[model samples]
Target: MDIKLDAAALEAFLRAEFPQVAGEYTVDRLTEDGLVLRMDVAERHLRPGGTVSGPAMFSLADVALYLAILSRIGPQALAVTTNCAIDFMRKPAAEGSMTAEARLLKLGRVLAVGDVLLRSDGQAAPVARASLTYSIPPAA
Candidate 1:
């Protein structure tokens, strides 16, 4: 499949539409197949146990898939999450940043599906995996 937005374009789109989260995530790499997103972890992302919270992990997955969709369809903030399923596989160390590798498995006019694998900055094993579905609203 062809990508409508490249790394630079994706970065700009995120900064413009989602300013609050702009610095939290970055488009490290983008290609014809998928994109690599880096999450800048902060103290707020952790729980009392010094581990990343489920909500934080979920947010990363959601953003990754959403960005993946935008990378193909251009800046479409109307694309919203319709459903999601996430599995927390391993505990993330509270020491470092996390990364989510997301890919668009399918993209259509009304819906998009993708999965994200998340791990600590240097860990090889995934800390979580999320399957997400996005609803693309009709263009105005």
Candidate 2:
């Protein structure tokens, strides 16, 4: 399917719908099949041992896949995550930003499945990987 939302539109949607996280995440790149997103790392995103926290990385992955689906399906604010499986692969730099690359594996009438690869800014290796399923609200 063709993209229904670009990077700017996704950013605006996030700012409007999720103001709390608007400043932390950025829609960096939107491709035909996926998108790249970045999350600014801060004190709140770090854990003991000076690494990015798992929850923070998971959030990035979730949002990335959510936006990836929306990019193709248009703005579906009610789309909800039905399932998520994440693997914490490596320690992310405590002070670096985190970037997620998400690709849709499948997009159906009611469900969208995607995977996200997250890495610390400037890192070549991924720090986490996540697969998610979102239940899209039925069209009115």
Candidate 3:
């Protein structure tokens, strides 16, 4: 499918529609299948062990899929996640950022399915993987 929103447009849409989280993530690039997203890890994103928190990783995966969907379907803010299954594979580094490679598996009239693999910045192996399904709001 043709891309409806590029990196710049997606970022702008995030800032305008979801200001609370707009600063937490950056759109690194968009590919033929999906996009790359970078999450700026901060102290607040860590748990007591000094590693990235599960919730933080989940948020990265969630937003990555959300943006991936929006890139193809335009800024449909109402589109929401219907299901998510995540696996935390390894520990993430305490410092730097995390990158989520999100790819759309399926896009249909009412549902979109995607997968996300997250890795700590500069790391080789994925720290976590997630499969998500989103419910797309019917066009008005």
- Of the candidates shown, which would achieve the greatest lDDT relative to the real structure? 3
Question: RMSD of each candidate?
Answer: 1.2, 0.9, 0.6
User: lDDT of candidate 1 vs native?
Assistant: 0.87
Tens-digit lDDT string for candidate 3 (1-140)? 88999999999999999999999999999988889999988999999979999999999999999999999999899999999999999999989999999999999989999999999988999999999999999999
Candidate achieving higher TM-score, 1 or 3: 3
The reply for model 2, stretches above 4 Å from the true place, is none
Reference-based lDDT, each prediction? 0.87, 0.91, 0.95
- By TM-score, who's the top model here? 3
**What TM-score quantifies how close candidate 3 is to the native fold?**
0.98
Model 3 misplacement above 4 A: none
lDDT of residue 120 for candidate 1: 95
lDDT, candidate 3, at 104: 98
Clashes of each: 0, 0, 0
How much is the lDDT of residue 41 in candidate 3?
89
> Residue-wise lDDT of candidate 1 within 1-140, one digit each (tens)?
77888888888888999899888887788756668887777899989978999998998899888888988888898899999999999889787788888988899999999888998977889999999999998877
